[model samples]
Target: MSHHSKAKQLLQQRDELDEKVKELLLVLETNNSTMDSPLVDAEGYPLNTIDVYAVRHARHDLICLRNDRAQWTEKIVEEMEQDEEKMGESAPIEEKPVHRTSNEPFVKVSSVVELSPADVGGFRKEDLIIQYGNLHHGNFKNMQQVAEITKEYENKTIRVTVIRDHRPVRLEISPKKWSGPGLLGCNIVPIAGANV
Candidate 1:
């Protein structure tokens, strides 16, 4: 019962304080303050009308400054990243070139032998001439102008590169006339760019 009584008393005091505050608000709202000389609170605080507005405006300015600083910091970080990339490009680091096999002009030939009637039908393109019987490559191919290379190049050991069973191989081609019969009576299609 005593606690309840104390609570009631405190509630009544709060009611009185609320009523006084309401009256003060009504007077302030109407701009009616009866004070002499300088208005001061019990705590001796001089109330300046501009103080409230100034404090609020100052807080707004602080927030804008913080936002600007954040933007500036982001810009600075972006610039730094660009600068680092530029520095790396100024003197590019040289890398060791990949070790590679020599690319000689002539294809390598592994085998040399005589040609006969049986082998003439199986010839395809990309055959390398490792051996040219006795005639050199230039002399043999250019026989169109000399006509004697065919005679000199015949019966001589010549080598060629071929692909057999999906593997690269070197074979020999000799001077042999076509003796086997074919299904189609078509004109012979000679290989192109044969250095002839």
Candidate 2:
């Protein structure tokens, strides 16, 4: 199979695995138990409050599934790198100046609070955001979209792409409860004349 096809298949499998992992985590949450939570009481007897068997099974499966997902992610990244190499080999050698007519950065990071989610996620001031979660320049309307995405993906990692030092950098940021006020604790302002 072609690298593109393989990558697509791997992505589908990864997404399926991710859904399964979420389901298992939900099971653990429903039981009011975490992976490290003690299934047995102080006397070494199984706790009557939660189903020890189900929690144990869920935790075990979660570990295995997470490992599998990591493997899939590695394969996907390899396939993507191979695809990029293949494309580069066939492309012309001439380098043309890039014109940011479309897909221009829609927002810029003005400030990032210390020790916040954005700070922990490697966000820096002046980072030009090209993509956040599913919102990109083409579909992005306003800051409200960014707000909605952060709200929707709270406690979950969101893939963000930014231009830092004229290079595209990918970072994973999760919006979650922290010591800070906001979820991200970053100030993002729309770029001027970006048609936001």
Against the unseen true structure, what C-alpha lDDT does each candidate score?
0.36, 0.80
Estimated TM-score for each candidate? 0.22, 0.49
- Model 2 TM-score (2 dp): 0.49
Q: Model 2 over residues 16-89: C-alpha lDDT tens digits?
A: 88899899999999999998999988999999999889999999999999778656755765575467667764
The 10 consecutive residues of candidate 1 with the worst lDDT sum are: 96-105
**Residue 160 local lDDT, model 2:** 78
Model 1 global lDDT (CA atoms, 0 to 1): 0.36
Report how far residue 95 has shifted in candidate 2, in Å: 33
Which lDDT value does model 1 have at 1?
45
Query: Candidate 1 on 1-196: residue-level lDDT in tens?
Result: 4444443454455455446545544444444333122345567775665243334444454445445543443343334334444445332244222211211112222322223321542344334332223333333344242224333435542333333332223344444333433221112222234421
